[model samples]
Target: MDFLHSSWLIGLAIFVVVFVLAQSMFFLVKAIQRAKVLKFQTSDIKRVMVSTMIFSIAPSVAILLGLLALSKVLGVIIPWIRLSVLGAVTYELPATINVVEGVFGQSIGQRITDPVLFVTVVWVMTLGVLPPMIIIPLFLKRIQGRVKNIRKKDQRWGEIFMNAMFLGMISAFLGYVIAPRTDAVTGESYVSLLAIFTLLTSAGLMAIIGVIITKFNKEWLKNYAVSFSMLGAMALAILYAMLGVR
Candidate 1:
């Protein structure tokens, strides 16, 4: 039996995907019903749903790109299940690489052949990300309650705290993009100029979109502004690469 294309694995993936879709539909219906009960206009609910769906496209495409890379190494079923569940490519790629190189002394460029090695990689990937799953289930309610208490005590401070957290995360990624690197042979300082360019381009495009939406009152553009900016930035990155920016 070919583990990579096993019938059972494909069936499992299909089942999981179907379950996820069903869960999403269930929640969406419930939310719409509750919104109606709260006297929300039907048009407002539809607009919210449409905007949310548009906002999700770019990120979902990014995930699909990750799935394509993972599929080359681990085959389709495993990556399909992982990405459909809690596994983002950020975590999944590193976990797979770490186990493949550290434990098996193999490269991910090659297909995983041995069942034992494959199983070990799967176990490592699963265990590495399992802590968050456990923690969320056990502590999420308490954490939410504490956050609510803080907000109740000082609403302004609570908003500031959340903004700070978001800024910290963004700063970390920005730092990574601009961090210095040395050429392997030339000993010259290098940085990911393409990444910086892409980041700035995306930011500029988003800012422009915000200005246009505010100044001209282009309300419909708000639904797709982020997606447009992201794709535009990605295209600029490719152009930057072609022009030897990095």
Candidate 2:
């Protein structure tokens, strides 16, 4: 059996994907039913669902790009299963590379030919991300309960806390993008100005959208603004690359 494209691997991938769809459908149906019980209009519920679907498309496409990148080395099955489950490309790629380079002294660009190395890579990938799954299940409810209590105590502070968390995440990503890197083409040390520009472009567009939505009461833009901003920022990144911003 081919380790990369075996029939059993494909079958397992299918099963996992199907399970994800099934679980989402279950929650969707429950949400709609609960909305109805709470006297939400059908149109409102449908609008929310449609808006969510629209908002998800851009991020889903980004994930697909990540899947494609990883597919070059790991093939389709492992990345497909990982991305379909809880693993993001940001985490999975680094975890795989760390194990491969640290253990085998090889780059991910090189195809992993040894079965033992492949198994080791898989184990590292699995174990590296396992803590989150265990911790979430064991403590997520308690954490959420505390958050809810705080929110109930002071709604303004709750909002501030959420905003702070979001800003923290954004700052982390910004720091990552602006970190120094060696130019692939020139082999010179430089910061990723293109990524920083792209990040700022996306944020600017989002802010503009927010202002437009608030000032003009353009409620419809709320659903699609994020997708538009992301795509716009990506387009700007491409143009910046063409203009030698990298």
TM-score of each: 0.87, 0.86
**Candidate 1's residue-wise lDDT over 1-246, tens digit each?**
789879998998999999999999999999999999999999888878887787788789889999999988898789889899878999998988988887788988977878888888788888887887789999999999999998999999999989998999999988998998888789999887888899999999999999999999998788778878988998989999999998
Query: For residues 4-110, could you state the per-residue lDDT of candidate 2 as single tens digits?
Result: 87899899999999999999999999989999999999988887788778778878998999999988878888899999988899998998888788778888896
lDDT of each model, Cα atoms only? 0.89, 0.88
Best by TM-score: 1
Q: C-alpha displacement of 147 in model 1, angstroms?
A: 1.0
Model 2 earns a TM-score of: 0.86
